[model samples]
Target: MFRHKGKGRRYSHNLKLASILSGVAGLVNITGVLSVNSLTTNVTGHFAFFSEQLFLKNYEMALIYLLYILFFLSGAFISGLIIEWTTKYKPHSSYIIPLSIEIIIILFVGFSPDLIPGISQMIISSALLFAMGLQNALVTRVSQSVVRTTHLTGLFTDLGIELSLLFFHHQKARRKQINKSIFLKLMIILCFFLGGILGAFTYQHFQLKTLLIPVGLLLFALWYDRLLIRYYHIKRKLR
Candidate 1:
């Protein structure tokens, strides 16, 4: 999934990509909410809060919400910048730096040292949002905008549109493609829900440490892809 891009990418690649990353996003989403009483995976709600605070003349609180949006945007900017710069020399591994950064952020927050309660919560929420921004950017670039794992708003909207199209578009080939797209969206939604469920259950016992589960999934994806590459190389040599 990380190795393919542009036209070289296939539906199966996106299927695998969406499946894993969406689940990770879901896990992070719930963990952030439970840990900080805030949403960390997306900034839509933050925008609303920012507006409300501004209207109430609570400038300090508004600024805090503004900072949350900026941090998430900054994370996305950094992820895209790294991918663009690294791709020139390391096309296949361009995603590693951003993905690694995300992993580090999650791991750090998971075992973060004690601090003032309010300050700690703020830091944790910002860090996870940043990590998620990194992840969302990486996946978007890797899939050429074909897959987005961080938020469901767009997915549900697209799914609804596409589902409607199925009734009007009658060509078999086109319908087949639409069906594939539908299935991909559904899988992402399903995995994200399941991930949230798993995170909620595990958090009761492990709390922040539950993040390690998604971290493990990411590590496995990296290792498994490398193994596949090696096996392909060996098979080509034998052929």
Candidate 2:
């Protein structure tokens, strides 16, 4: 049934994975946005544009931004569909499929940068955005939304809110809530910024080949998840 409970000690690993995934998302997004002038992960900016276009009666731009919103929603929807379809039968392996797909796309982008222009930069941007959304949604679901790896505006806001609450309201429940929220938000923000810096440097030096970094991170995540599953299985058997 994949029940999620936040026992302080138990959530550490999930938090770690969330931070790493957030960093990967940030790097990939910055790479795509800088290279193509299109956002690859978060859709907040797209939605804002859509709203402005609607107000200004710019139907053409509105429709374009609306498509971007749909694409992002489609990604999350597909990820959830994958999880729902597989979780009842093979719960442990569902995330691997999306992660694998993302890796392949990234590798293709790295190897054939010209494909972006040939297919139209918008299409390439949408593909990367979809992949990022899928990855972010999967991680968020797995962590029970206690962690979100993409979209830093909310994260930063949450961090500030939590910090303020921690000092203003020292009640146990308030303190605990603030602590957890702040920790997760700060971890995500820091990781994403670090990733952005690394991505910029890598792009400066290696250009498109910098895609390898995200690919490597995904592979590492897969390996780590597999190890955790194996360890849990062994412990269950011993018990």
Candidate 3:
């Protein structure tokens, strides 16, 4: 139900949606990290780090990190499976489905106070990971591979290198190239950090129930996408 590009007046709308999505990703990462001691974003790095730790005699820390990595991978695998299974019926999938599922899991954890210690955290982390994967994939697809909402490490690194090139190298073409990359990279970093701050505060004060904001954002994304689709159809008909 989403379009990669919007027409004329709606161009700005797409950018706004991307920003909101990035913010949601940030919030999820922050919440997951604080509550679960795991990262929902950038599981690949987590995997590599955990692997190294495992080899270095830090078994406890490695196990915990490994769990996070596995859960995140599980999430991505689930998303991929869903897409593969539905490809025949639906050519494209909306991120709202997985996001809704993630919210449901969060609510369940929030309401059931007893579910925290044992296997509940693992399950919740898995759900969060899956939601993040779905979100990242959706944005990548919708933006035609131009945007990523989760895991700002690479984004920050890219931004740094781009800025360095912009200042150090006097090549005008290279400067223009680096500036655009830096802008989007910075945007992702800021959105994630802002989301993280909000998430940390919410979780600290409210506990596991702080996912209402992200749920609301998902609903809004669905509604906004529908509205834009309808607007496009109407305009096309008029022409």
**Model 3 per-residue lDDT at 192:** 76
Q: What lDDT would each prediction earn against the true structure?
A: 0.91, 0.77, 0.69
lDDT by residue for model 1 (1-239), tens? 89877788889999999999999999999999898888988999999999999999999989989989988998899999999999999998898899889999998888874333335677898999999999999999899888999999999999999999998999999999999999999999999999999999999999898899999988888887788779878999999
Tell me the tens digit of each residue's lDDT in model 2 across 16-56. Answer: 77678988887888788777787778888998999999999
> Whole-model lDDT for model 1 versus the true structure?
0.91
RMSD in angstroms between candidate 2 and the native structure over all alpha carbons: 3.0
Q: Which candidate is the best by TM-score?
A: 1
Which of the two, 1 or 3, has more TM-score?
A: 1
Arrange candidates by TM-score, highest first: which order?
1, 2, 3
Stretches > 4 Å off in candidate 1: 113-119
Q: Estimate each model's TM-score.
A: 0.96, 0.86, 0.77
User: Number of clashes in model 3?
Assistant: 0
Query: Cα RMSD for candidate 3?
Result: 3.9
